[model samples]
Target: MPKLLLAGAGHAHMAVMAAIPELVAKGHQVTAIGPGERHYYSGMGPGMLGGTYQPEEISFPVRDMVESRGGVFIQDKVARIDPARHVVILDSGHEEPYDVLSCNLGSFVPQGVVACDNQDGANGPGAAVASRSVFPAKPIEQLWKARQRVHELTRDHSIRVGVCGGGPAALEIAGNAWSAGRENGGNGCVVQLFTGGKLLRNMPERVCRLAGKVLRKRGIEVVEGSYVRSVQSGEIHLENGKRYVQDVIFLALGVRPSPVFRASGLEVSEDGGLLVDQCLQSLSHPDIFGGGDCITFVPRPLDKVGVYAVRQNPVLLHNLQAHLEGRSLKAFDPGGAYLLIFNIGGGQGILYKSGVAFGGRAPFWIKDFIDRKFIKKFLPNAPSETH
Candidate 1:
């Protein structure tokens, strides 16, 4: 049997877990390595913040899911990959060799871009610090923990909450934060959204207008052309010389590719993501496959969206199986258009697809249904299914 190693318990890898029984039946031994035992669904993150869902509702225990399907689950962070030797080095200094390897490790927030205070004050007074007041909205689990801190802070004081970034995720975070403040009886909580450029640049103009209207109605200030320079204690300094006082700051800046790829000597994109071809196989190393936020599809540049990652699951699985069987692999076609639904809180959502955009309770319901269906597939008691 061929030993197959899977790295990262991300959305793309979820498909592999769902197909584990089939893979094992075909005489392939599968092993998964990741830092955490649970996989948090980013789709439900905003809903969780808005008090629409509980934490357990948005995540699943990864080990149980993989183990139940007859796969070995290794709970450790992959420190590096030695492509030549087909070995993956764990953070614990242990190495695992494999016949084939697949990576779906998600991205992380770039460090030192926004200075945070060092514990020893070695960086100087008023240095920006990633203390309890600063939150990076990635790695999902950290964001959830930070939300708890935000809840506690708002419970006793009226603080200015600032969110940086103009993407759909940032907009959703702003909306949910506003709703959370209201629900916590902190109506006096001032929410400010700072975008370095136009809001929802990737969406249609009508979508942008709708989002602006919603933010206005929610009393969240929108600051355009305010590129963040650095964060200091209780303040965010912008490149335009405008300073905003925010007791709590949420970084909605989308993630950059994990640095592990570059360190492993894999050919990576300018953004440091592992570069892969249409088949999702590494351009430099044929035996390696990758998808999700960790890979840059070389056939055509793709938006780093969850939809793209989820859509690539089947292709990834097929290619993996084909590679193991010594058969021809199938190319993956990333469709030009995919549904994008932004939960704007208050039981409302904005939906955009192929230049058309709409928002209302109807869209929110549609999004809720889709999210629930996706989560249901991985539930322990749910029937086995693949997206």
Candidate 2:
């Protein structure tokens, strides 16, 4: 039996966790490592920010889920990977050897935008300033905690909230933050969304118009056609020489791939994501596999979205088992046009796919049903599946 080591409890890895029993029965030893015990479902992120769901409601306890299936779970981050020796080095200096390894480590916000000094003159005077007030909307937990900070700060005075990025996450954050403020006695709070390009660029123009309408209705100032050049204390400077006053900033900027693979000499995309073949196996090292946002499928590059990751779960599992049993591996096909539902807060959502867009209460219910169904599959007794 080969030792299978799963790195990171990301969306695809959640499938592996749920199938641990079957994998164990097939004579494979499974070990999983991640930085935290819980994995937050990104789909419900907007809901959480809007006070529609609690932290526990959207998070899955990865440790308990894996351990219940007779697999070992390590709550630590991967510091490095020694591909030559097939060993994973932990931040604490421990090493674990494996016969096969799969990584689904999620990406992070670009460090350049978030790395600021904690003290005076940390990044030098007049340089881009980053303080505790800046928050990145990735890794999920940090964003959840940032919401608490926003609530606390808004308890006394109205603050200007800035959100960067043009993707669905950014739109959702802006709406949710505005809703959060209004519901929490900060009705006069101001919200600004800065996007380098048009908002919801990936979606159809109709969807974009709907999103714009919703944001306008919520009084979110959408600054388009320019990106943020730098952020300083109490203000954000745009590339177009425009300045916006902000007390707190939330970055919904897209993620960059983890550097662990690139540092290990693995074949990686220009963005530093692991390059994988059709079988989801590493192009440079076949013994290694990767999925989710950490990998770029060479033949058909996919957008860094959770829907693709969720779809890859079954393919990854099939290939892993095939490799162990010397059977033919299956290729993953990311078909064009998957359903994208954006939760716009207040029991409303927008649905877009294949250039058709619609918004109504029905889309919100659909999104809620789909999200709850996904959570229930991996989580036991998941709050009776309510919309």
Candidate 3:
């Protein structure tokens, strides 16, 4: 029997984790490893921060989904991989050998790039995340803490909020945090977004124009062309030596793949993502397959978006089972233009698709509808009520 080991319970691995029963019935041994029992859907995470959805509504019980279906679930993380030995090294110093290994190890915020203000490194970086005022958006759960922190700080007085980066995540975080602050009795709370360049520069021009209009209308200041040098609790330091005081800071910088791939000495992309072909198999190690943000698809590079990861689910499953059974593998088609929606808080959103972009309450509803449906598909027990 082939031993199939799955690393990280992320979006691309959701289907694989849910199919543990069938894999076991087919005489395959499966084991899944992750850091959390629940895998939160990042698409709705900003909404959660804005008080539109509760935490439980946006996360899947990945560990329970695996263990209850005849697969072993290890509540740990993959520290490194020894491809030559066909072994996975756990952070706890344990080794798990596998005949075939799949990685859905998602991307991470480049926090290390920003120097922490705390010189002693005390109560930061390596410390508890919730206890800190600075937050990264990639973890998804950090947004929850940001909301709570806004609530807590706003109790005393209106607080200034700073959001770094100019990407979609930065926009959503800035917008959502604005709405979250009001719920905590914050009056005249200011939200300043330091874009470091043209706002939403990677997106379509229409998206950029519409997004800027919405943000400006809501009193959120957009600081363009000012790159961030570092961050400290309650402060933002721009590269030009300008400093602004803030009660909360959200680090929504561009995401980079986990250092595991590059650290393992495997083939990697310029961004340190595992290098893979059209089949999503690592170029240097045939037995090692990966999807999502962790992989740089060589046929054509894909953006670090959840939609592409969701689209890769079925193709990855098919290829993995086929490879294990000595059958022919299939190629992954990235599909055509996908629907892009940004929840800009206050029950408003901007929708873009097929080169067309629009903004309104209808767009927000459309995004909410689609995101909830995705959760319903995986977790039928999830609540359907909107916030």
Top-scoring candidate (lDDT) = 3
Candidate 3 TM-score, C-alpha based: 0.94
TM-score of each: 0.94, 0.93, 0.94
- Residue-level lDDT of model 3, residues 207-294, one tens digit each, is 9999989888889999977798877666788888899998888888899999899989999999999998888899999999999989
Give lDDT tens digits, candidate 1, residues 1-387: 898999898898877888888889889999999788888888888888777788888887889888988999999999999999999999999899999899999987653546666577555433444577787778777666656766787788776889888888889888877777767575446889888998888778999998998888878888988687777666878888988988778888778987889999999999999999999999999999999999999989888788888888889998998999999998998987789899988789999888888888888999999988888886656555542
- Those runs of model 2 whose alpha carbons end farther than 4 Å from true positions after fitting are 115-117, 124-130, 380-387
Q: What are the Cα lDDT values of the candidates?
A: 0.84, 0.83, 0.86
Model 2 Cα lDDT, one tens digit per residue, 1-387: 788899898898767777888889879999999899888988898889877889888888888888877899999999888999999999899998888899998888764654365666576433343576777777777667767767888888888899988898898888877777766576346889999888888778899899989888878888888888777665677888988878778888788888899888899999999999998999999889988889989998798888988888888887777777788888989988899999887788999877778998898999999998888777733221110
Model 2 C-alpha lDDT versus the unseen true structure: 0.83
lDDT of 3 at 20: 69
Residue-pair clashes per candidate? 4, 0, 0
lDDT of 3: 0.86
lDDT of 2 at 337: 83
Q: Go through the candidates in order and give the C-alpha RMSD of each one to the true structure.
A: 2.2, 3.4, 3.6
Model 1 spans > 4 angstroms off: 122-129, 385-387
Regions of model 3 farther than 4 Å from truth: 117-131, 380-387
